[model samples]
Target: MIRPDIRTDWTMEEARAIHALPFADLMHRAQTLHRAHFDPNTIETASLLSIKTGGCPEDCGYCSQSAFHDTGVKATKLMETEEVLAAAQRAKASGAQRFCMGAAWRSPKDRDMDKLCDMVRGVSDLGLETCMTLGMLSPEQVARLKAAGLDFYNHNIDTSPD
Candidate 1:
């Protein structure tokens, strides 16, 4: 049986032992735990939009938006606030509960914070959860976004060797 205890200090060996479980047994334990905590049949829907496209300064190997890559993607300026609001509305009409915006930049400039906050507010006003992936954010930017009703900020570490 899977332990019901919640822990934040799992050691590497403990994690490895859990990973080494037989596939069937692992799946059974996972299903059991999932059924105990969540509705297995319910699924959340989210939509992603690239608010600013291409011309990123970061040299991430897997990203086509990197300026170092010869990917045929052309850089475009950030979408206007109304355009983003329309897209969020469309996403909501299509049954999406969350709307995510992405921008191709090393980090958003201080000057752009106002516009980004407007976008967040607009999406939130539409009754959809707002999320963004605008590269590294300063503490001030984070505070502004939080004040604008930003629900999630995605900062994924892509370790692909491609």
Candidate 2:
């Protein structure tokens, strides 16, 4: 159960109005809203690791990892659980409160779930919060990640189907 207090039914007009607000007005509104739900003085620090980089099939223009683009990024295989754990440990030593693992995938393959789960569990064992951006997930996949102790799922909503 996450953000049960927040409204999810904002109309497109309302959303557009919010987005179109002047920078200062938007900033003030954002801070006001944030303060209502959170301690404004608290800040979070996170270390991001690309567990799997490049060769994404999605044609999202914003990502350099898209295979359709001629980005210099070289595609790599999924990282081992040990490698990810090592990075998490380093992140913890560097004062990172969270570890973010990402993969350049439209959706992770079924075979990759084990490694992903293991990575999450390992990061959590180090006492740091775990987050991942593995693109879309099936219900079963989501359950597995939850079981493995994922604290957050960070998906980029690059566009919305209106």
**Highest TM-score model number:** 2
Summarize candidate 2's per-residue lDDT along 43-116 as a digit string, tens digits.
99999999999999999987899999998999999998999999999999999999999999999999999889
Name the lDDT value of residue 12 in candidate 2: 89
Q: TM-scores of the models, in the given order? A: 0.84, 0.92
Model 1: how far residue 112 lies from native, Å:
0.9
Scored by lDDT, model 2 comes in at 0.94
Question: What TM-score quantifies how close candidate 2 is to the native fold?
Answer: 0.92
Cα displacement (angstroms), candidate 2, residue 143, comes to: 0.8
Each candidate's lDDT (Cα)? 0.95, 0.94
lDDT of 1 by residue, 25-61 (tens): 9999989999898999988899999999999999988
List where candidate 1 sits over 4 angstroms from the true fold: 1-6, 18-33, 158-162
Candidate 2 deviant stretches above 4 angstroms: 1-4, 160-162
